[model samples]
Target: MTSWRLSRNSVSELRPVLSYPFEAAPEHGELCEVAPGVYWLRMPLPLALDHINLYLLEDEDGWWIIDSGIALGPTEEIWEQIFANQLGDKPVKAVVATHWHPDHTGMAGWLCDRWQVPFYCTQGEYLTGLVYTRATSEHFGWTNEQHQIRAGRGQVGADAARKSMGGAGHITRSLPTSYRRLEEGTRLTINGQRWRVVVGSGHSPEHACLYGESLNVLISGDQVIPRITSNISVSGIEPEGNPLREWLQSHERFLQVLPDDVLVLPAHNLPFYGLHHRLRYLIEHHEDHLLALEEACSDIAQTAVELLPVLFKRELSDSQIGLALGECIAHLNYLYHRGQLERSVDDEGRYRYLAVDDTLPMRLRKRQHQADTELPVQV
Candidate 1:
């Protein structure tokens, strides 16, 4: 579930509106101290986005590693280097995976086995990872091919997506069979400081973000990023899921609970300080997209593939098409679930969406307006 657009142009306009607090990023395989006893590490990804950021927190006896990198030769090599050079004499006491995505938790089992420590993450994420890893097997019937076909992707597109998913190595060979579940409000004492877990969904099942009130740091695992919006897609498992709505609500919750000045350490981008600004930006960004999509479907019903050009103006590569399609369906499902649009299955087993009317109902319009003008919650 590497949810990212291959083309940066899709988010170019939003990028200039936000600012990065840190100019320097950690070199690959190296750690940069973002806060006292907390270090940031960047691992190389083989995709267009190119990198994922992992964090290490100094604990009482050892270190707590957050968001392990993908289980690839290069990524494992980087971890080896960090163990030899960066960790000094301290051993990794625990491996904390923010979610089930390979880029985030691919090395959880490997790290836990190496350190003989327990794996920490939400129960949903850990269980989903098991499902995804098993899905790579030949005997697994629910492949990405079927998922694409169910999402209105043509046969060619479905085949291409299947090939890409198989090649991505998303499901690590070694997945942890056991884990320690971290739920909302669960706090862990690391190095005399408390880090509380805050769970959010839409991007992944039970995505856990750690908030340290004393340090005013939020380890936002793919939940909130400064530049790019996290991928909120309608997967085959939950085809009718309105993840877009869940994603926005999660931001609202963040605004309610988090202080504005907390430095956010995201999974993909550089560390930044504008938590509320970024959250509001993401909310408005999707709202604008939903408006455009609603208008596009006013006359003719459209498939998720047909609406790609409406949402993403730029051309997409074969690999990006699947992700873009999933994202497009997410927005369509949001509108469909909200009564803004109507959905119907065609003769070919494809779902088409059409706007219900030219104008939204009073309640939906008011909701949209509130989202447009809503101010960030003051801490």
Candidate 2:
């Protein structure tokens, strides 16, 4: 149901060119060495985006895993094969999840229990995962109904959304009871090399990306991918939150601090060299969406549901509607928070957004200008 794939609006000729160093990905059960002592492992997901990239960081004593795939039987079996044949007989030292997504953390508990090692992730990611895994099973349907209804879905549409909520194969595994926190600037020494934790939000709270300075490599977990822009949504729990703003700000910060030439190992796509260019593409992609959405809202008040076609022109599956609606609300909330749009609620409780004026906000204008004119940064 989660549409983790790239949206229809993410593609444009203005997108920066990226260079893939690897011609092909390693097979599901095998591992490929991307850098010294850093191994890339691919796993299969049952979603539209069918694969996730996991990494292994070699330590003097043992190996550290970047992420654990979803807790399905086949995924567990894949781990078993890797343990038996691929690990070179080294014991796993620690299990680390880049964020709280099911695809990233579902098998974390199982791995920690098997290896008798500590589980590590940011506190926000760990706590949020507990909330979703513990609470969503029973309340997901009812909660989704209310959320969609408020976004202008009719009873039939809302019912369809409710039916598509939690069932089988949805984040079935719970996280370990405890975990070591990976915060911003946390440095970890592995195999005599240091990897620092770079945390970002919006995609998930405190999503952790690991940076190996000496290797000029980054294990970027869904924050910066080569092919697809990560799905940034305003959750049903926090309707007014400005996650799009947070998502954009996080990318802007990365462009400033991270080096341009880091070979990024993203969770979804292949490893590539173009950190800064890709970051700008992501920022501008959302900016273009915001401008189009603003213009669409100028003529008449529109509900989040009504604006879906403006962002995604392709047909959406029943499972994808929930994800699409949440993303729509995120863009609306971004403009609403910037005072470029005004929101109103009807007696039936449907929310509508209308633009305040034709003039673009100063901040939005400034960001567009910077993206167009700024030269390549050395940092």
Candidate number with greatest lDDT: 2
Record all residue pairs in model 1 with backbone atoms less than 3 Å apart, i.e. clashing.
Answer: none
In model 2, the clashing pairs are: none
Q: What are the runs in model 1 whose C-alpha is more than 4 Å off? A: 1-19, 137-147, 162-171, 358-379
State the displacement of the C-alpha of residue 48, model 1, in Å, after optimal TM-score superposition. 0.5
Q: What TM-score would every model get versus the actual structure?
A: 0.88, 0.90
Worst 10 residues of 2 by lDDT: 1-10
lDDT of 1 at 74: 91
List per-prediction Cα lDDT, in the order shown. Answer: 0.79, 0.83
lDDT at 368, model 2: 53
